[model samples]
Target: MKRSLDGFPKIEVNTQRKEGKALKKEFFRKERDLLGEEAIPENAYWGVHSKRARDNFPFSKKVPPSLVKAYFAVKWACARANLEVGLLEAKIGNAILKACEEGMEGKFNEEVIVPIFQGGAGTSLNMNINEIIANRALEILGYSKGNYQKINPFDHVNLSQSTNDTFMTAVKVATLWQLDELEKEIINLQETLQQKEKEFASVLKVGRTELQDAVPITLGMEFGAFAEAIARDRWRLWKSRERIKEVNLGGTAVGTGLNAHPEYIARAIVHLNEITGLPLAKAMNLFENTQNLDVFSEVSGLLRSLAVNLRKIANDLRLLSMGPRAGISEISLPALQEGSSIMPGKVNPVMCEYIEGIAIDVMGKDQAIAFSCSSGQLELNHLGPFIAAHILEMIEELKLGINAFTEKCLRGIRANQERCNELLEKSFALATCIVPYLGHERTSELVQECLREGKNFRDFLIEQKIFSEEELKNILNPLEISRPGIPGFGKVEVKRP
Candidate 1:
């Protein structure tokens, strides 16, 4: 076997003809079955197929780092399983394990250069991983790069595995990793909203419906609703992991475990769970797992649901913090940066706007994932790469966007106490508070009367002598009106002339 001198391959210098000049360049000629004699960079660990893929899908720059690490974990587990079943040599398996361990520790991340938008049912991505790993393992064993005949990328690294099983398994693992972080971001956002809820608990405001005054509500209540919605999303996200935990790791090619030992199938999943620290299990029916990709659709639906919630929350923040002069101004968001060059002292809700845009993008990506996952043929889904890439992008975008909103906008939010009081005083919706004493008809009349005279509801009520000042104070208590479960509020004692 041709081996490196110091257990590591060094870049080789070669002469090439370029522009009729004798040019010296560093290259390595790696051969492949389909595309033979391709000149690769000498220092590159990836091989012919990876180069082809890089050239083919130049639009997508690279694969997600999480997926690359997850792929390495799958390979590491497979190597251990093969070695355990006496199918692989100890030296080769140990070297593969070392490379995978380094990969999991983020060592070879830069080498994961496969573009995410490739075809071939993820075969290109799998080959990219196999080539990088095999060449790196060859280096650790004192073998030269591209000496695959001796250290065989397919035979040694990808033994007992296929693109269908390993790639899907890695996608699931990567998604689980991303969801864990997303759940944290969701919880952080929820806690921040809850904190604001508590801070605004006593500040009363006029609630609106269809852009018209509806009833009395505390500023805390609105923020509390946002917190509750995020809390629900956090729970749903935690449960989403269970849906993807069942993997078809043992199902090769078409879910039959072809050319793979049955023992390897069973043991590989166990090792994967150990390596990934996720509660992954082999599917009860490998055929079903292999043929169907609806699990991604289901998870994407949950993410879509979350995106919808985030959009609503963001829009509410935007509307609530509309302006200091002519808008609702019930709440004020932190001034992130200068809003416009033309408008001085003006600040925009850029963080909320950013979150709104992210939510819209996530929803769109979810639609793409759902449609692509359904485009699977009989045996396998050709759109697995697209689905995986979209899902990971959604999770990452949500995580980053939620964290940014929490830190930049949510944490610094404050209630507009003066505005809340002014709007509440002018709103005739407070007539609903006295609806129990004087039925809906009389209350509506009072509301109409106050609106027609352009008089504030409190002033109108005091002018009518429906109740004395003390009685109005007791009747219009903000907490009493907005508190929950206070139905059948007996008649307020009215002292009339």
Candidate 2:
């Protein structure tokens, strides 16, 4: 019954109880380098290094759950490799493997207490994982949780592995897993856009450049471009898999595979691939793979491109759905919530705005990742934890944003046919339909005349006797002008006298 500043009890293991009293939980002393022996809770599935990390780096409550699962997978693969090469005994290896499998299933997650950002190139996180798995494996073997003499975290659980290789490999594996979800979300967004494209296929609207009406285009075609951009993002997400698939799992400390069996080094990645069910391959040049983190930077660039595309689409949506009374009002977005506290019925493009914010965050993370990747020196890049944190954040945010946009906005959009036709009728750029026959100079003269007189282009064409009503109707067909492939619209048989 004790309390700490964080409002949680300073937990102590129960070690003794007098006769007729229930026994208190027991604790054991664990010792390490530079730091002396300390009492670790007997029930807690982590060792002294983990406790040290919890005290040293109080940045966050914990790392991502995906990362924990990925580390479990890595440790299990290492155990398998160690057992195969006869470096670790079968009984201890089997127990460690069981603990790892359970860890992947989300067991022992409470033991992963270290913050993601720490010194030592993720050594603290790696040791924390090693400790958790080792303690849990010892418990499985009917020994105390902190009994390192019988089942040591470093000697048995972390055999044939180093923090540099294992942690980086785990980061890539976890990133790929998260990217799988991101890919699905991107595909969903693209499909929604394509559906909207088909729905608005025949809706004619004026296309603008520099905020000035330049020509005519269908609303469908505009949405089709959005879909195409998302499709490219989807492709980029898939392509990133190849770049990250090359991992350095066996290249311990400095990628020289020192203190690890040659057989263990050769087979460790094979076991990792089997465990993760990912197409992971060991790097041919372990040193380069361990030293250079450019692959993550490349993936970050792809993610940044996705954010840019998302921002463009969201901005267009905001513009298109500006106002019901005075703005473009070309399309109406679904009203999910009241936009203003004072104004009644003022619904905003909140979903698009939310997506825009997420895009900006993703782009920012990409820049941070690029800088972190370049900051690495010599045998290791200590910036991996930072890179992993940002990449995962970007993926999760984009996934959620895309899903919200698809469900709340894209699916519920309704085109204003009247407004679309109204704008097209008002746009003089439609005069370009007859430019081939009338020549640019003649078309320009007519356009200027219509603008100067404040007359609609259609009426001016009819008044000038350039063509009869039927001919003008056929020439200025909105759909034909937007797509511009009709047979006779542009074919001038004779010049107007």
Measured by lDDT, the strongest candidate is 1
In the range 94-200, model 1's lDDT, one tens digit per residue, is 99899889888888778777789889889998998898889889889877788787677799999999999999999999999999999888989999999998999
RMSD of 1: 3.1
Clashes of 1: 0
Q: Which pairs clash in model 2?
A: 14-24, 14-25, 14-26
Model 1 clashing residue pairs (backbone): none
TM-score of each: 0.94, 0.92
Q: Cα deviation of 340 in candidate 2 (Å)?
A: 0.7
lDDT of each: 0.87, 0.85
Number of the top TM-score candidate: 1
lDDT for residue 228 in candidate 2, whole number 0-100? 97
TM-score of 2: 0.92
lDDT of 2 by residue, 113-177 (tens): 88888877888889999998888887788876666777898899989889999999999999999
